[model samples]
Target: MTTGLLIVQILNGLQFGILLFLVAAGLTLVFGVMDFINLAHGVQYMLGAYLAVTFVGLTGSFVLGLVLALAAALVFGLALEFLVFRHLYERDHLDQVLATFGLILLLNQGVKMIWGAAPLSVPLPAFLTGNVALMDGILYPTYRFALIGSGLAVGALLWFIVEKTRTGMLLRAGASNAPMVSALGVDIRKLFMIVFAFGTMLAGFAGAMAAPILSVEPGMGDTVLILAFVVIVIGGIGSIRGAFVAALIVGLVDTLGRSFMNDLLRLFMSAPSARATGAALSSMLIYLLMAVVLFVRPEGLLPARGRT
Candidate 1:
């Protein structure tokens, strides 16, 4: 690949990694601290995009739409926690999976009914519509740079909150031993609510930011949900640092593999065979990476401190 193309691909990979981190960060916290399974977290992301479309359309302002979408997502997530998830917390994981999966089906259909089956797009704000030159001949989308920058900023903020704040200390303690944290006089349930709400907002913000780049449509969050799961597993279930690092790795491997596998294969095989082999191998690259990581470090690359 040419230098410019390679640079662009790297940026694309970084952008994708940032998006994955946003979803996975919240997911890891809920899974790690609350020990709860939320298969419908992806639905929160989808809802964010859908909400952004609705609000932005009404107001013609991207920033306002994003804020409103985040608020709505937080409220809706709390509602789900109250109406559905709280009951499942003490139940078996099988029940959590079944309940959340059903919610996914319900919400997917709900979106179709409300927004129609067709895909929707969000118009970028004027400041975000153009491209910036990385070099004399290379350019990248301004919005993507903003996405990467914002994700990094969020990552830093998340690190601060999780590493420095009282809530974070409680979250870490809960992840290590929930019953102990509860016995220590912390309202564990309230903490759960806060964690779940924060996670919902993060996932929603990722969706709202991504709406301009990806098609806003029904069931769009399913693939992202899967990727987020992979991210948590690789990063260690409860570790924010692990999630950030693993997300960037997974994003780079997946993006770079898809972009250049065929060309790389052509150096050793015939064109048609290379194309077939490249496509197959590229699709498996992330999973293979996951398998390798699990094999080497069962707890993952950077498991949380108390995970053992």
Candidate 2:
């Protein structure tokens, strides 16, 4: 590939990384802070996409649809917290996992029942159409550029909140030591509600952003959820900073490897053998990266509470 195309791939990798970070950010915090393992988090992502589809159909505006979808997701998350997740806070991780797994099944089936098994999507606004040339003869989609911009904006906002705000301070404390924070007389229940709702909103936002680019369907979140888990594990569980860094690493590695692995392998083997081997090798690259991270830093690069 030429230098220009390589630059575009790098840009593509960055954009993809930002998108992954958006989805994984909340997943990391929910597990890190509440000490709750939520497998159904993926369902939140799916619901966000579906809600956007429905709202766009009704209101016929992307901005209005986003507002409505976020509102619905916030409500749904709060309801789940009140009805189901609150009880799990005091329970063991195993129990939390089982309950959330059940939720995944229910939510997936519920989505199909309501929206049907066929895929759906909301259209991007006309303003987001077309592409801009960044370099000689190279153009990239406007929506993708917007995605990178929005994701970075959100990440910056999140960083500022976590680093500077009182609520962020409490959230960090909660993630570090929930029991200690509760002992300090803060309403831990309320704090959990805030965290849960915010995290759910982020995941939903990711889903909505992705709907225009990716196919909107039931179980779409499953693959991305697993990738998010891998991101957390590689970055260091419960650390937003770690999640961000890890996500970028995974995104670049996965994306670049897929595009270049065959070429790299062909140096050592014939084209047919390189194609077969490269495909498998490229697929394993992220997991291999995770394995190396674990071997070196078993607790992850940034453990939420500095606990190891």
Candidate 3:
């Protein structure tokens, strides 16, 4: 790839990573703090996109739609927590998985029934519709740059929350030892509810942000959910810092690999063989990285402090 092309691809990867971090951050927290295996998390992301599209169409304003979608997502998440997830918290992991999986099916079908089975699209705000000059000849999409900036801002905010706030301390402590935290008189249930709602909002926000770029359709969150899981695994469950680092790493590796793997492989193999091998290897890159990380530090690269 040319230098400019490479730069663009890198930027795309970073944007993708940012979205992944947003999704994974919540997933890790929910898993680590609550010890709840929620397979329906992906559907929450899908709900965000659907809500964004629906609200935007109704309001004729992207910003307003975003606000409404986030609020709705938070409310819906809290409701789910009360009606469903709250019951699963004290149950077996298998029960949690099964319950959440049922949610996935119900939500997916509901989306299709409400929005139709066809893909939907959201218009970019006029100002963000074009591209901006990155260098002498290179240009990047304004929306993507916005995504990267927003993601970074969110990441910084998250860092501050986890590192500087009392709630963050509780989160870390809860992840490390929930029983001990509960023993200290902290309302563990309240904490879980808050985390669950916040995580849902984050995932929804990610979906809203991504709606303009990716197809707004059923099951769109499935692929992203898998990536988020890989991110948490590599980052170390319950470690926001690890999720951030691993997310960027996975994004770069996956994006760059898909873009240039064939070219790199061509140096050592015939054209057809290289193309085929590159495609296969690129697809497996993140999983391979996960395996390597597990082999070296099974707990994760930056495991939460005090986690046994």
The candidate that wins on lDDT is 1
Residue-level lDDT tens digits of model 1 in 182-294: 99899999999999999999999999999999999999999999999999999999999999999999999999999999999999999999999999999999999999999
Which RMSD values do the candidates have, in order?
A: 0.7, 1.1, 1.0
Local distance difference test, each candidate: 0.95, 0.89, 0.92
Which of candidates 1 and 3 reaches a greater TM-score? Answer: 1
Q: Give the TM-scores of the predictions, in the order they appear.
A: 0.99, 0.97, 0.98
Candidate 2, residues 1-308, lDDT tens digits: the string is 78877778888888878878988899998888888889988899999999999998899999899889999998998899989999898999899999999999999999999999999978987889899898879898899899989999999999999889998999899887889999999888888888889899999999888888888999998988988998999988889999999889988998999888999999999999999999999999999999998999998877676555
**Candidate 1 lDDT score at position 233:** 91
User: What TM-score does candidate 3 reach?
Assistant: 0.98
lDDT (10s digit) by residue, model 3, range 1-308:
79999999999899999999999999998998999878888889999999999999999998999899999988998999999999998999889989998998899999999999999999997778899998998888999999899989988998998889999999988998999999999999999998899899989999999999999999998899999999999999888999999999999999999999999999999999999999999999999999999999999999988876
In model 2, the clashing pairs are none
Error of 3 at 132 (Å): 1.3
